[model samples]
Target: MYKDLDEFITEYQHTADFWYDVGCVMASEKLSKFGSEDWQELSSIVHNRPLEWQKKLAYCLDTSCNMYELEILLSLLNTEDEELFEICIDTLRSFTTQESKQMILDNPSILNRVNDLLPKAGIVSKKMLEDFLKKLNA
Candidate 1:
């Protein structure tokens, strides 16, 4: 429908209330995972009812979602990549112990690439990557 994550975020930033209904749809289609404690825990802080709500939410979550499943869910911003939806499953398969830095080290080369770009990225970017690394180290 939306076409891409960027598009979804953009649209949501403009009108996130739509997501209330979309969330309902997701619920109906068994998308309740988006409402789970993990999701709700994070959503509680980010889900603000404002014109810029979704953008802020995306920013907050993007920074905070260090775990693989949460990282994968961020891609939901991408609207057309239905196949990309498996990010969560793939992340789960590559699960890491909450107490192991090996998880970050164990991540595929691609995540390394993502990390590599961190220092040069903006504040949020650097913070997000750093947070992920922190979790791994924790």
Candidate 2:
């Protein structure tokens, strides 16, 4: 278990296991403190990492991120990588707030892709996507 934020940064910065360990630490009982800088750093990491690392970090960010961080996740919807696109959509489903839904709706490409892909991926029911689209258009 990590003792504190600095310890986590000092030990885990720049490693293959960084995100996985960060996720574990975030989920653990240690109660790591995250400031704006920490969140920004994590967001940068998410944006810069490869698809696999982004996938792993997405799981961590999903649980810990704020709305701004969530927008970072939403941006991943534009990725041409099929697996990453699916993961972003699945993660976005949990964020049902108006802002998130609007973000999805505002992006025609993302909205169309969600309509196209969700059915094939089976991440969400077709009816649910239809309802969501209805809400967006309303």
Candidate 3:
């Protein structure tokens, strides 16, 4: 694994597989040292990377992500790529706290889009989808 954060930053930051590798590492490690700067770096990678890379990173984030990272995951909902959008939505399902729910409902359009897209994605259970919709409508 990564020896330390600085080493990871210096050596992997500009590599072609940065996001993919970082995502895997994040999913597997607590990496609690990550602060706003690290989140920004990860977010930047997710925002700037190719669709395939984005999908891989989204999957990794889905496996394990914190509240601070929710916005990055939410931003991915805007993608037109179906696979990426589905992976993003699946990742988003993990953030079920009141704050996360409210943050999502704050963007009515994105919430509505989630309502529209969930069925097409066909990844979430019917009950879970219903609960999410109820929370959004509430």
Candidate 4:
């Protein structure tokens, strides 16, 4: 688990250090989000994967996250934490890449879940999600 998103991104991008390598990922809060491996305690604490760190994951959702990070990303959509929620929204909206659009299109559950959350979203977030959904559906 990362202390914040930058560290998560840094580690994933391979900009951390040459030493931080192979340990694809680790889940947040000491829980195994993906169950890939026992990420070394120090490395996970120091850094973790390599594209946006596996193509910069948030940007590569369509390329790399389809099977692994999708659930984590989806879970973040409901967070009340302002910072995290913002990152989630920003990362989600960045899915405008053609492949990312297809990622959402391929997963109807993404739409369904977003729709389900509409009634619960705050005014600002609601509007953002609405526009996001519209673009994807369009």
- For model 2 the TM-score comes to 0.62
For model 1, the stretches where C-alpha displacement exceeds 4 angstroms are 1-30, 33-105
Residue pairs in collision within model 1? 3-80, 4-78, 4-79, 5-77, 5-78, 5-79, 101-136
Task: Judge candidate 3 at residue 39 and give its lDDT.
Answer: 72
Candidate-wise lDDT, in order: 0.39, 0.59, 0.62, 0.48
- Say which candidate scores most in TM-score: 3
Give candidate 2 regions above 4 Å deviation: 1-32, 122-138
Stretches off by above 4 angstroms in model 3 are 1-27, 30-33, 62-65, 118-138
Off by over 4 Å in 4: 1-87
Question: Per-residue lDDT for 93 in model 2?
Answer: 59
Better of 1 and 3 by TM-score: 3
Compute the lDDT for candidate 3: 0.62
Q: What tens-digit string does per-residue lDDT give for candidate 4 at 1-138?
A: 433533655544344332224222432322333244422332343223432333333332322433344544554444444444444544576455576677657767657666776898889878887888777766
- For model 4 the TM-score comes to 0.41
Task: Put down candidate 2 lDDT per residue, 10-49, tens digits, no spaces.
Answer: 3444554655565445533232355566656665655565
When superposed on Cα atoms, how far off is each prediction in RMSD?
11.3, 6.0, 5.9, 10.6
Better of 2 and 3 by TM-score: 3
Question: Against the true structure, what is each candidate's TM-score?
Answer: 0.34, 0.62, 0.64, 0.41
Full ranking by TM-score: 3, 2, 4, 1
Tens-place lDDT per residue, model 1, 1-138, is: 112322344454324455544532432233223434545444444323342433323333322234523543443333233223222222222334563235445556535554655657667556655655555555
Better of 1 and 4 by TM-score: 4
